[model samples]
Target chain A: MPRTRPNLLERQRRRLVVPFLLPALLLYALFMLYPAFTTFYVALTEWNGVSAPEWVGVDNFTRLTDDSLFSSTITNTIVFTVLGALVLFPGAMFFGYVTQRLPLGRLYRFLILAPVALSVTTAALLWKFLADPNFGAVQKVLRAVGLDSLASVELLGRPNTAMLMVVLATVWHGIGLWMMFFAAAAERVPAELKEAATLDGASSFQVFRHVVWPLMWEVTRTLLILWMIQGLQTFAFIIAMTNGGPLRATEVIGTYLYKVAFASSEFGYAAAIAVVLFAAILVLTLLSQRLTRRESEQY
Target chain B: MNRRSLLRATAVATAVMLSLTACITSSDDGDEPETESSGGGDASGAPAEITGDLEVVSFYPEGSPDFERLSGLAEAFEAQHDGVDVTLTFGGGQDVPQIEARWRADDPPDVNYGFLDVTLPDGGPWVAAGDTMNLQPAMEQPLEGYDGTWEEAILPGVRPLISVGDDIYGAPESVTTLQFFYNEAIFDELGIEVPETFDDLIAAADTIKAAGIAPFTVTGTFLPYMQVYWDYLALRHFGLDGLQQAIAGEAELASLPGAQEAAADLEALVADGNFLDGFRGVDFTSAQMSFFQGDAAMILMGSWLIGEMAAAIPADFQTGTFAFPTVDGGSGDQDGLFGGTNAQVVAAKGQNPDAAEAWLQFIADPANQTAYVESTGGISAYTGIPAPEGFEDVTAMLEEGAAFAPSYMGVLALSQEVQTAYQQPIAQLFFGEIDGATMLTQMSEGLQAAAG
Candidate 1:
């Protein structure tokens, strides 16, 4: 059969689409796409922000192999992401489950989410004060309990404990958001299905394992990816608390990029680091989505 | 739906377009009125009679004492110059990053209050590209009231602080001398004398430590404050020139016997627990508070410390300062001091270069310099200006031929990359995670990598 021409309304709608989409498309290209392409170009040069940019194709990428600081930054980012996911995923889910069953569930949720309201900088500063070796409340309590040795340890100073402190601070501030996500997912589960599981003599854990867990896989996968991206981009708290010290122990790729660009005036090298970070996040996100994807199921 | 409605719509659209065009053209014209002359200043070596905005950006935040003094200086300049409006912008101690962003945007301020040091990559790029105006010719001219030239009015050692080779890039405004400030009561109570040699300093520190007080306290988190120890040690070990040469990568820092020994000495201090507990985690304010609270017996700080900690300092607490002790078996000048100068530079690409230069000269004049010193408790960078009443002792110390040696990180004689690479390793060395030899190796490798 011969192809039919579009109706009058369809033609008008098609013509109208350009006028409506033009502004958004132009904005995206100017702000996002333009900078991204410029970053790729900048990654291949030795521009110091002020002087003329000198082209050095692939030199920055090659230098990464010999750049111990960059390597350490990558290692730090990976460790943070993996450890953060391991802690936050189970912790948020468990808290969400327990709080949902409590008599004062709303109060519990409110209490848990209070920290999320505080800005990241404020939370980091509060934690820094609390971890102070000399006059912190934590140290005072530890000393009172006769754990003088533990009290004497400087959590934010030593390389061994600095990253751990930063991780703890990050989790404390972030756990609430993930918990709220899981709680919302739990609220959406069918009560009848839960009752049926209960009637089948399933314990709370077993019901969650068999029914709720399967249903919430989508939310859990999204949370995991979000946490991974955030962990990779962690910088503000580390900067406020440790400043990538003592001895670059907490130096993630984000902080390292900042140092390279602003502190060292190596804009090209910094752009290369940014590109690598973006690539890693993209690959990891794709892999995660592929792995977590499931066939549609009836509940 | 007749032709009349369509005609009305077109008339409204046309009216809007015409009004918008009128607004744009009027605003543009209002912003830049035609000038009678394009020259920067008139005759008699004064800033030209120009009517325009002169914007100044500074690191001194509004609440700071320096901020008020700077504002007053700008006001005085505005008062003297007719038809010139001056606006001051404060960066709250983040001037480097703020200035960097503005400079990259190609819209830097008319006058920038900053250090001219090239070691840490703060303003070095602009200086190297000649983005800042050369002030040599301006300096040769005499101030309004001062009979002598601006160059002659500046203190002997201050001009070099803001100069790269023979070209002066900025006018030196204030000076700060780093010294070992001690609680006089603690020294008197412990029956300890002011140390004059490295050995004597160590003995004094030991006595303080034995008394269950920290010998010295420093803000290790900031890193630069802790670098003072390394700077003094290097200076006392190898002379000033030798240290500069090492920083410039002309010589290996580790190869210098003095450098090696200095590293070892610093490590020894760490091993002996001479610093406050958890000093590495403390910031500058807290470290100063620890000193003021008498938790530490001594603190190595700049002259600005007296003013910064004025409120916290006890009324009965007497503070005494001494030059960094000379190292035994060292070839450096015993009286050399580590410190920095506060200078102001004019943006070459700014609209009012002559107004900026005049403002600098106004600030550098003997009368304004004295007022600034009095207000901020900072040492003046001008000669023949009597020291502020509270800082007479420091003035005397400076007068005793205590040569000025800029901090290694201050003038950025070394690239920022090299400095950053050394920062973590140096902290590790301080924490005993790495030995002196490891630190030296790391420094050498980092410098080599930067060079490559």
Candidate 2:
């Protein structure tokens, strides 16, 4: 049978979709896409945000290779990303599982997630006071315990410990959210499957390893990507706590980008750093997605 | 309906929407605020009657003494100029960024309170862009209710503090000199006379350390405080011109014999454990607390330290300041002092230039300057203004100094990258993580690269 043409009303409604979408699309283009494309162009120029931008080809990128600070920042970003994943992925999963089996689990979850309610700056400030070498509670406790030598060590001052301290603060603030995510995923696991496995003499650990873990793969993968991105973009807590000090010990890509742009007024160079960071995040995300991709299982 | 009619309707709708969007988002070129003409000139060529809303922005937040004093000044200016309405915007610590955004948006405040140096990028956006009104014209005019020309009324040392080339962009509100602020009680108890030479200073530190108290305390996390020591040492070793040359990339910092000596001296200070325990980790406030609480015997800070720690200072605590000591066999002029100006500028593109100039002139007036000195506990940039009673030592030191050397870190003459290059290494030097030679080498290399 010959298909009838769409009515004028239907055609009008169809046409309205584009116009309706145009406002949001225009906003997205104006705010996000435009700045993103501009950032790429800016990466190749020598703009100080005040004067007109001067095109410098790949000069900024070349400079990046020689920038010791940029190299160190990259190293810092990688370390944070890797360490964050190693800590959060399994740590969140374990806590989620343990809390699921415990009495008054809600209280435990509430306590764990409390830090998430505070702003990164507030949490950082709180931790800074706690870690203060002279009069902080940690130092006080250490001294009280006759560990005066340990108490004397400035945790946030030394290069070896500054970054770690920042990361720990970040984790303390973030682990709750990750745990909640995993808990929700764990809740969705087929209870019948676990019960059947238990009936088959499979231990709780065995059931979790074989049944629960496999089912939670998709959630875990998504969490890993999110954690990786968050880790790469870490800035506020470090800025509040260290401001990339103790000899640039806690300098990360995010802070370095800020310093380059605002402190040094090298917008072009900063743009280059930002572009590299964006690309790094993009590549890692895409690679992780590919590796984590799997055929849908009929459970 | 037929397909052809439907297609036509769709095209019409698309065209209508496009036009509407274009019309809604179009820029209004005609709506730009008209630049008001200069107000009618008085006998002195200054505005006869300053009128209009003058928006003044400051880094001083509300509730602070500086803010209250400035607010009073604004009220006084308003009372004097009947037609003018002075609006003060307090930005806390975000004044620079706020002013920059306003300038970019073409809505800058009539007046801006900020640091004078354009070299330090964070001071204010107007200096680098030449957006501030050239104060030379205003400075030549006699200050209202003052005894001399505005320029003459301003302290000679502070005249050049706010200048770029021959053009002065801002009027200094106060002058701050950096020196060792020691507890007079501690010094008297320890029998450590104010060190006159580098060796004597080191010996004093040794005696203080032997007494089981840190000789010096600094905010190592805040790189600028660490740089203060390094800067004074460099100034003592190489002199102002030599250090300036090094900062300008005309000479390598490490290669300069004076720089090497300064570095070695700094290393010696570190090796002697002069700084507070775990100083590398301590922030400015913590370090300040340590000094005020007597955990540390002395602190190297600006004159503003008194104002900042006014409440924190113990009731019986007597503070005394000494000039950075001379280094034996050093090339630097022994009488040079490290300090800078806290100045205010009028935005060139502001709507109320006439009123802004009037406000600046009023601030420069002796009575207001005196009030600022008293309220802020800072040294006035206006000449003949007496230092506060408790600050006689700093005043005497300032008077005795042969020349004022702008702080190395505060001088934006060197790019921040170059500054950071030395700053981090200086931290290492303090921590004994890197030697003085290594720190100097890094500085020299960084300066060379920055120059290129």
Candidate 3:
């Protein structure tokens, strides 16, 4: 049989499809694609965003090696990202499990979700009041008990302590969102599967491990990728709390990028850093997807 | 083609094109008209009646005292000149981020306030590009009751910063200077006199530390405490010209004896644990609270601290400013308190140049200067303007063989990048990890890179 091709009417209909799609495609191209392309292009030019750009080729990227704050920012970002993953992932899973088991699940959900509703800036400011070294409630209670010697300690001044404080703030602020995601995932686990685990006389922990955890791996992995991306972009809290100071101890790559771009007016250098960061994010996401696919295939 | 279908198609196409044209034309209207008026007096030099829209942009936001004063001035100018309308836009913080954004926008503010730097790192030299307007012609002519020449009016040493090669780039409005604000209760309890020399300062620190009180509370987080070290050292070792030369890439940081000595002294201070524990972790508000609560004996900060202290501390707590103590055998002059009067300048492209000039003249007047000083407890920069009554004695003391020295003024004459670069290494020196020699070498390299 000869292959039958589309007749005139069908071919004309196919042509009409492009016109219908053109407006949306044009918008996406203008807003999203253009900026992405321009960011990479600008990365190669020494433009302060003030005057005409001077083409500097790879100078911006080369300068990153010599940049004093580059290593520090990368280290800060990695530390914060790892800590965010470690603390939030396990804690969220546990909270989701507990909330599902609790008698008043609604109350538990509300309590857990309350912090997520607060803005990062507002939360940091509130924490500043709580952690304030001198006049804070914690210090007041300490001083009242003849613990006046501790009154002089600058909790926010010590680099490690400050980093810890930021981690704590971030984890607390982030817990609810991840918990909700995990809780929904765990809730969707088939009732028959859980019943079978129980019928086998599996312990409570055993059921969670064998029945619930396996079912929720996909959701957990998805949340982890999302959190990792967010963690890499973490900046507002540091800016509001520290502005990457105390000797640039809190200067993560995001804040450093902002500084290089806006503060120093080194748009080309900033663009290079931004592109590198974007590429890093893309690679991590793809790796995450690949892992999930492999795990699902095994099942 | 059917006649009716062709007509419908043409109508639809026309409608689409019309909508597109409407969108494009509307955006064109959004382009703010650029105004470039070099305001001048009438032939007789009498005040000219201004009659146009005056556009002003400030880095300071609404409700800040500086913003309030500026806006109030704008309103008053608008009312006085019926034909002039003043439009205001608020922008960036006292940081580089805001300036870059404003500079990049197609419609730059006619009256824009910027840091006293000549150029940004990526932006070519401001003077070379003529990006910034020269204020020399306007600044040269003085208004009535201004009394003194521009040089006579401003603190003598500060002229170098505002004047680039031959032009005045920025008119200083508010000068932020670092001063030692000691807790009176802590000092009194420790039985330590206010320190007059480096030895005295060390001895006082020891006494406070022995008493179990932190000797000093500082926000080293982001080099908050570094300013004191730099300003104090500059006062002792570099002198204004030497500091200026180092900042300009004309002199190497290593060549300056004061830089090494200051760096060494900072290292010593850190090693002795003279600062608040975890000082590097501390932010400004926390460190300030420590000082207010008498947990520390002293804090080094700016004149604006008075406003903060007034809000934070109890009514009865005593707070004051004093000279940074001199180093033993150091060349620093103790009397030179580091700060100067900042002047306000009208941007050349300002729409309401006449109205802007009126506000500038009003603020620069001696009477208004006194009012501004008294209201804010700031020093008067205008010649013949009396210092706020109680502050006169202290002002005279700071003025005695003392010059106004802004911490970053020298670095400012170069570019903002060099200025920000020096802050961190100096901060590292405070951390005691890096020595002064390394810092100086880094500073020279950083400055040279910025120049290139």
Indicate the worst ten consecutive residues by lDDT in candidate 1 chain B.
B28-37
lDDT of 1 by residue, A165-269 (tens): 888888889888889999998888898999999999999999999999898888888888888889889888988888787777788999888888876678999
Which stretches of model 1 miss by more than 4 angstroms? Answer: A1-8, B1-44, B50-52, B68-86, B92-95, B114-123, B388-403, B409-417, B445-450
True contacts kept of 2: 0.47
Q: Number of the top candidate by TM-score?
A: 2
Instruction: Report the number of the highest-lDDT candidate.
Output: 2
Which runs in model 2 stand beyond 4 Å of their true positions? A1-11, A297-299, B1-52, B62-65, B75-95, B114-129, B389-403, B410-416
lDDT string, candidate 3, B340-449, tens digits: 54545454434444455565655666666776676666666545666653346445644342456665454433323576556767777767768776776777677666
* DockQ for the candidates, in order: 0.27, 0.42, 0.37
Q: Alpha carbon lDDT of residue B250, candidate 2?
A: 86
Higher-scoring candidate on TM-score, 1 or 3: 1
Winner on DockQ (1 vs 2):
2
What would you estimate as the lDDT of candidate 2?
Answer: 0.79
Give the least accurate 10-residue stretch of model 2 chain B, judged by summed lDDT. Answer: B27-36
TM-score of each: 0.88, 0.90, 0.83
